[model samples]
Target: MKNFIIPAIDLKEGKVVRLFKGDFEKTKVYSSSPEDMAKLFEELGFKRLHVVDLDGSLEGMPLNLPSIRLIRKAFSGSIEVGGGIRSVETCKVLHEEGIEFFVVGTLAVREPRTFERMVELFPERVILAVDSKGGKVAVGGWKEESSTSPQELALKYENIPIWGYLYTNIDRDGTLEGVDTKPYVEFKGYTKKPVLASGGVASLEDVKKLMGIVEGVVVGKAIYEGRINLRELL
Candidate 1:
């Protein structure tokens, strides 16, 4: 079966970088030019892009509109953004700005009512992000842990109009040790909704392994550092 290719763009103060073990304090700046990186991927023919605003992740609202606009334009394809989205108002605006989908992490884990409202209003326009450590959902850039298990909330939203879940292993993100398959396998027998796997992906085999569990996969450090080629994947 064919799977979707979702390239990751983590923005911090207007540049692309990847976090190690979910630490925002110790990010390695991979691309000084996000537009260039996005354009390159678009040129390689990817259908959609996964953009995470690291600053937005912390601030609870989008901080890099200009750069996001540049990336939105550069790709000319679907862009599913996750970061600093804490309100229905914010969701409405970005949705109008041409964002194909929104990924809500911390808010979803804390305020299930808000997430439900978002789904009721936007339907398939939202994607709940599950970035976890030890199978528990981690929010606030992985600094805060919720009592909720990733699978539980995922299963709850299974039939909701939410688009999918972007599953990332906080410990494996930017580690390049290889992609984490444990949490995804945990999701088995739970929800039929698609999962978009993220973090620590270094090669095509990793992509192949995540095949059925995810609707797509987000590649960050690997593509930037040259461990995998977008040309080969897309």
Candidate 2:
């Protein structure tokens, strides 16, 4: 499989933004147009795009479909979206709107059966988002802590057709400090599934370090803050 350096375009109230450590109140708007950012990522040769509807994640449903639609219209590359995707119906809607993959989070751990059904239906298009903090899964936009550990959760779906896991360190998300590869290494060791690392990617070196262990890495703040150049990174 080809490794990916996916740029994340987080949407909040129709604008591109990034939140600090998953805190909604602590957010910084990077751009007013998500479509422009998506187009730029595609122009820079990124094969895939990671988009999250921050408002939808908090509200328990997709709230930025219009923004997503605009992004799809602007960028022809593969798109993988998350945030408040908790049901099969929502996935179907996004699929119809040109989304290539669905990153299911809150529903994956809280509703395994539903998630399994989605995997069965979508096949390789369903990726599980295992957002973690201190080694445990955090759900509902990182507002609710679950008893499930990332390893345990990955193990539970070992036999399923789910595409892979997007393992994010909630504490490091949008922090731009660096990444802790230990958790990703451990999760991959236990499940042997394709893993995509998210959060704390500060520089090209950070991306290179994670490339060895993860199938891909989702970078946000670093790219927006001009800390890493997408053109050069690609």
Candidate 3:
């Protein structure tokens, strides 16, 4: 498959923001109206949008549905949502709300059975979030480190029918440093499922470097901070 780029809209307190290294305390608000941001991306010719509920990630449920709803209404395209999606019911609800993909991590690590059932129920709709930090998988909104390695967690769901994997290097996230293709290179060896590289994507060069290795890349800070021009990607 051709590599694609996904623009991210992380919602916190009903505003679009990006956090440094996944730290909530270091968030930088980009837009107050998520709907407008979603519209901008759609108008720019992006076919897919990545939305994360920052409040929901910590609160253990979807708290930004209002904002998300507006986004869904504004953008007539597929939307993959993450953060605080911990149950099968949540997935069903989000699906009804127009979310096409579910980005899940904590549930996959802490509740394997339920996670399996979710995949069984949703089939190719689940996107396993293999978020890495300090060589370990981070869960619980990136607040807690898991005992399992990124590869181990990924391999656990290798056989399960999912959308693919969102492999985020938590350490490099929102840093605008540059892409670290080493981990992603190593990560691809463990599974055949599509992997979407996230974090440290500082320039078009970084995106190009990752294009051949992974199925897609999720870009946020770089696009928001003026480092990356979305039109160029087209």
Candidate 4:
């Protein structure tokens, strides 16, 4: 296991921000220039990034396309984008814009057939995002809850040719709490696809705890809050 530590950038209103447990009202703006932040991550030698459009996730359409275009121009590494990508055309557009992977959650749960078609068209470019709260899968930017559990959803798409999974713990997200490995540990048993842990990663030790278990971890609040030194990942 490479223990890939991918940093995250959450965009809201064309600015970089982090929301507490997926609550838009509880947001903290970290930077006004997202591309500059992307460049900094590239300078830190990070090979991948996890970016979400908070506004898009709620509106069901990409509102930060201009900012994302700037970010694409600034960073050379692989980037996975999520939020309001509900159709294949949007995926195609983002792919043309240089995004390597699409982190899809709401679409997959709301319309599995459409999501499958996306995978069929893009192949290894789809990353299933299973954001969970109290063991149930949360959707629509984590504003709505679905009847499906993370395990069931993971297994449902296990046979599909997706890039991998980005499993986030909504309860721990942005809380600065230490990561809970049990959920990830249990989630791993359901599928063969590589899984990336996200939410509430407070320190390097938390990253170390998840090393060799999942494919990687997507950390945002911890890194932006200065709790995690970016260089240490190298």
> Over 4 Å off in model 1, which ranges?
1-3
Candidate 2 lDDT score relative to the true structure: 0.89
Lowest summed lDDT across 10 adjacent residues in model 3 is found at: 1-10
| Model 3 agreement with the true structure over 1-234: per-residue lDDT tens digits | 112889999999999999999999998999999999999888888889999999999988999999999999998888999999999999998998989999999999999999999999999999999989999999999999989999999888899899899999999999999998999999999999999999998988898899789989999999999898877656
In the range 1-234, model 2's lDDT, one tens digit per residue, is: 123688899999999999999999999998999989988977777788899999989898999999999999988889999999999999999999999999988998888888889999999899989999987999998999999998888888878888898999988999989988888888889776689999898988888888779899998999899888766654
Model 1 TM-score, all chains together: 0.94
Report the number of the highest-lDDT candidate. 3
Among residues 3 or more apart in sequence or in different chains, the pairs in candidate 2 whose N, CA or C atoms overlap within 3 Å are: none
- Candidate 4, residue 195: how far the Cα is off, in Å: 0.3
Our model 2 lands, by Cα RMSD against the true structure, at 1.5
TM-score of predicted model 3?
Answer: 0.97
TM-score of 2: 0.97
**In model 3, where do residues sit more than 4 Å from their true spots?**
1-3
1 versus 2: better TM-score goes to = 2
Candidate 4 per-residue lDDT over residues 11-91, each given as its tens digit: 999999999999988999999999999999888777888889889999887889998998888888899999998889899
Q: Rank the candidates by lDDT, best first.
A: 3, 4, 2, 1
Q: Write the per-residue lDDT of candidate 1 for residues 1-234, one digit (tens) a residue.
A: 223667789999999988888787778998788899889978888788989888888888999878888898888888998898988998898987889899998888888899889889999889988887877898886788888898887877888899878888877888888976877877755777778888788887888888876778888888788887766653
lDDT, residue 215, model 4: 89
Model 4 Cα shift for residue 219 (angstroms) = 0.8
Local distance difference test, each candidate = 0.83, 0.89, 0.93, 0.91
